[model samples]
Target chain A: MRIGFIGFGEVGYEMSKGFLTEDPQAQFFVYDPLYEKEETQQRAKKTHATLFSDPQSVAKETLDVLFVAVPAPFAEDAWRSIWSELNEETLHVDLTTASAQVKQRLGEDMLNEKRTFIDGAIMGALKVYQHKVPIMVSGTGSTSLIDWGKSTHMNLTYAGDLPGDATNIKFIRSIFTKGLSALLHEVMQAADKLALDDIILDSITRTMDKEPFEQIINRLISSNVIHSQRREKEMENVIDFLNSHGIEPQMTKATRDKLKMITQANILEKNQGDPPKDWKQVMRLVNCT
Target chain B: MRIGFIGFGEVGYEMSKGFLTEDPQAQFFVYDPLYEKEETQQRAKKTHATLFSDPQSVAKETLDVLFVAVPAPFAEDAWRSIWSELNEETLHVDLTTASAQVKQRLGEDMLNEKRTFIDGAIMGALKVYQHKVPIMVSGTGSTSLIDWGKSTHMNLTYAGDLPGDATNIKFIRSIFTKGLSALLHEVMQAADKLALDDIILDSITRTMDKEPFEQIINRLISSNVIHSQRREKEMENVIDFLNSHGIEPQMTKATRDKLKMITQANILEKNQGDPPKDWKQVMRLVNCT
Candidate 1:
């Protein structure tokens, strides 16, 4: 089997390591602007991959499979630069953290050229999963890619048939992962102010002992109407306290805004006679408003 | 032992049930506007607590300990309504989810009036823990209150001498819990649009197989310099995608704002030569900028 990689940055490097570790007999080719850099050169030599000076040369190598592991900002440009070199036989796959729109455009362009394009997005840290990361793939060629990936012990999921479904799933998933990080960052700042960092962390981790998702959903629905007014006021106070401590409570501020919107919409008052029975019902009330 | 409850709402009622279950011999008095409601009356009867028409009457019972479990907005009013009724022998502990400023004011007022006031904040769902919920307490009287709670098998922590320290911690913790709910709501709505709700949820819960806090912090720091630019752009796309789908991405919007702030401050560029070694280092760089 022959393979080519574009962009030997952190993700690209880790991916190469995983690929070589898993399939040592597979031939490899590489093309990155930093190919001449000492670290890049050493990595290429260590992996025993044939390195090419330009993307055109890597594309012209006529590899059966290609992984475009460029940075998100440079992904579209990179694909365009190597567009002419790829033919119908090359199964071109993207591994950039790009938007659905960008992925859809590239996928459509490739399909127009009678080439296989699989929109792929990694859902975990490259350092942790390397090439075996959970990759959400979409497009007509996704099934074949998933089959190929599974054979090599690479974790891949065929998201849907649409060009951008996989990327969309990934961006939406970011709402959970990145949002959690931002929340923790804000909380840690406050914990530091009180010199209660360790205790606060311990308290939070302990809460994780329970099913937080169920607890959260139950509390949200059961107390949605009973406490919205007071909760909103407390959130306003949170904004003040965070500001006083020189921290921008972006998430807290948004929470306050949302709470205010809820009260203004008067959904609770309207549903007072017949309150929501569950979290889903509560969401329906919210949406109706 | 004599005890009085200043409210008969959801939290107040659950607490009464738990306390009575643990100490059946303890005398109880209650006061709330809803005390006349069927549910409140039924709960008080079941718990064998004496119902009072007003906070003043409940205070006049000369209780050994009193719990203020009113809503956050009405907490101050409830305290003031019974201020003249409380005496030196009464240990008044608050369980409302109020702002630190409000808790501090009431605590100071109680101290000046020769009554013990412990600023306490419940750290879990009241429905789950009831009177035994993990309560973080702070103030001059917190130690004694914690000891009293411990005697009854209640989970209590003495935070510090200051009146508002415990409340501060609770408000800070809210950022994580409420922030998480907001993120989940946003993601669920997007998933619903694509009819991929189950798969998206499965993916997120799987990611939780790892230590989320450590994973989040590590990813945030390691990719701080390399992916910030791409991430910020992707977030912008997330905003547009969410809007196009008619879902207000409150958490997603806040995340974008935060990422923009990080990039705008250019902290990564300054620390390029010596990148942040950990989450704390990353935060220090953020604070420095």
Candidate 2:
């Protein structure tokens, strides 16, 4: 098997290293702007991957798979540089952190008789999962990548048959995960200030882990429509408490504002002062408003 | 047992009803500005509790337990009105959604030799948990409340001996829970807009429930110091994506701003470019700067 990487950064290096573990005889071709750097060269040597000076040089190889692992801004340029030179049968999997729109545009640009374009969104920490990091893929080429992934022990899930579906799911998922990380950071910061970090973390962990996440999500979203007004006031108290302790309540303030927006929507009045049956009902009402 | 509630709202009504199921012989006394309202009258009748005209009347009953469950703004006033009239042996549990500082002030005001002041922070939805809602208590009177709670099956956790410790913990916890709720709301809204609500919810649920919450929290906080810059840029992409879809992106915006703050703190540079071992190290570095 022959594989090519358009950008040899952390992700490219880690993925190449992981792939080598599965197929020792598989040949690797790589091109990177930083190919001359000591670190990049060292990484290349560690994986025993042959390096090319440019994307076009790497693309000329008869590769089974081509992974574009550049930064989001550089993703399009790198793909374009190698597009015409690549074998039509080679699977082109984009693994950049680009927006779904950008991925969709790339997918459209790759449309042709035999070329396959897979929008691959890495959904886990590459440092931990390496090449086996959960990658959600969509687009015309997702099936080929999934089939290949099965043999190579790659963690790949087909999101849909649309070009940017995988990236869309990932970006939407980030709305919750990234927000949660920030929220926890602020909570822990306040806990640290109060010397209650251990206790607070324990309490939060128990509360979150006590129930299935679906139930928690349901309860929170359902009650939000009815209780947003009261919750908005409660958040004011929280903001006051955090501010008094010299912690800027950025996330908390956003929470309060969001709650305030819900309250102002008068969802309770619209629902006759009753909680929605579940999050879906609330979402339905919210979208209508 | 004689119990009094200074506010005869949902919490007071539900708690009284719950206590009746546990101890039907327990007498209930209640007072609220809405005592004259038909709903308040109906609630009082159902709970078989006597409704008093003012806080003083309820306090003068020489009760075994006195619950002040008014709104946070009215909590201090209600306590002040009833403080002198209440028997010293009565356990005064403040369950208002007040800031920790307000609770602490009330705790300080109730620091008499015989009086027991418990700062009670209700930590669950009353409509669901009712009287059994998890309540965290602190201050001089926490032990007395906890002791009584044992027989009544009240969900009580003693936070600490400090007056406002329970409120502090609850307030800190709100920073996470409320923020999460808002984040989920925004995510689900965007998902609905894309007609991918079910898939997005399933994806988020799976990600969140895959591991113990402690491990998740640790991983996010630890990686944050090292990856905040990258995550910040990712959040920009998220904002653009959300904005393009007509979602407000409030919580996502906050997440991005927070990541920007962490990046600006130069935590990665301070750690010599290595990820922190855990959240504590990140907190330590965060606190120092």
Candidate 3:
């Protein structure tokens, strides 16, 4: 079966390989805008699948299933450009962290073309993609299409007749789980500043005792991961949207303020290259732990 | 040994009962302006402890250890008005959740007089007080005093040769763990509104297989407990106080905003009742397994 995978990002590439990992005999074709990056190029070398130059080329490949491994809201403008290029025979399944509203638009298009559209979301990270993480798929008229997920070595859990059930779950959970990681970064630091770092930890531990406190603290606590720092602003954007919707942002606001104070406050003072006061203190705090 | 307890509120009364639970021979006495509630009254009835009418009566009894379980800041001022009535031999242990500033003042006062002062923070609910959950204590002249914790059944973990060490840990952990519970509330609801709750639960279960998700989510998720409907206002107060110290309020703003809209826009307006939403629905949003 020819499978056309779009958007070879981190999750995208992992899933593409996941499909192959489940069934070696399956023919795979992939396309990503950033596929020329050194990492993507190296990934392509190992996968040994058809790498298309553009979306149209992947679309032209007489694919049985068109897997959209793109990012959240994968494409703006209602995915019109990508939709217009797809063959009517191919089925489309989105594995991105997308919203139901965006999926509704694409759902209308898929229904019009009489093609199967599966609302899908990956429940686990890349390394453990298909092994234990059953990819949850749901939507109108998807009972027949999920067989592809099952056949391709993916444990497909049929999520009932909702147009965007799985992705909806992924986004909401991410808002908190990832949001907690962000929350930990902000709260721990704030408490640490008050010279109540241990007290802060105890207050959280409460009646529950499980993981080594340090591991949970470090993962949730800030370790100065420059890459993760951007999440503060992104969380702010989410909180702002929640605020616009008249809902409280909770940890998202705390997260944003912390990020803003650390990242942006320095820009105003012209302090460059020096780590955030928080970044430095977190290290010292953890050492004391 | 004559052990004295001030403030026969739930925590103090429970801790005193816990003392009796393990060591029935340990004499217990309680003193509070207000009478103990039903739970405490029942405990005191069963334990057969003497109830003193005022703090002076307990102090005049010349107790080996005086466990002050009263509320803080307010209690700080409360103690000030009545402190001159107490005996100098009393080793004061404040298990109340007082601020660092209050502990510092009290610690300094006791230090100058050569009286032992132990600052402690109670962890877990009263149920776990003597059974398992630890009560952390911080103070140098604490060992001889805390030996009664063993004879009279208190699970005490001492920090260092300082008055603030134990309280510091409790406060630091509180910032993240309790903050997590608050953060979970907002995100869980976000999932609930979106109707992607199951996926949210599955994602966390799959992603964080080792962590204790159930207890954490139960404490934070709104469905289980009625998160203060006025949570936004209360959280803002929590954040503002923390922020006044140059330490940020971690989940303060976001937690407030995340729920204010939903509670105000959805639950408060559409549904009416305590814990108006089902707890499972809320936990499903936190996606903690």
Clashes of 2: 0
The native-contact fractions of the candidates, in order shown, are: 0.44, 0.76, 0.35
lDDT of 3: 0.58
Cα-based lDDT for every prediction: 0.77, 0.87, 0.58
Best by DockQ: 2
Which model, 1 or 3, shows the larger lDDT?
A: 1
lDDT of 1 at B58: 91
DockQ of each: 0.40, 0.75, 0.16
Question: What number of clashing residue pairs does each candidate have, in the order they appear?
Answer: 0, 0, 34
* lDDT tens digits by residue: candidate 3, B188-279: 33434444545555555455545564444333444312443544544554454334424344444554555454354343223344353533
The deviation in Å at residue B44 for candidate 2 is 4.6
lDDT of 3 at B278: 36
| Interface RMSD list for the candidates | 2.5, 0.9, 15.1
Of 1 and 2, the candidate ahead on DockQ is 2
Q: Which wins on lDDT, candidate 1 or candidate 2?
A: 2
lDDT of 3 by residue, A1-289 (tens): 6787787667656666766667676677778877677776777666676776677677778888777777665553325557667655677777665666667667777777876677876765566564335667777556766665566666677776666766556545544554454344344334434445454445455434556433443343332234235546345444443444333345555645555544543322233444325322333322222
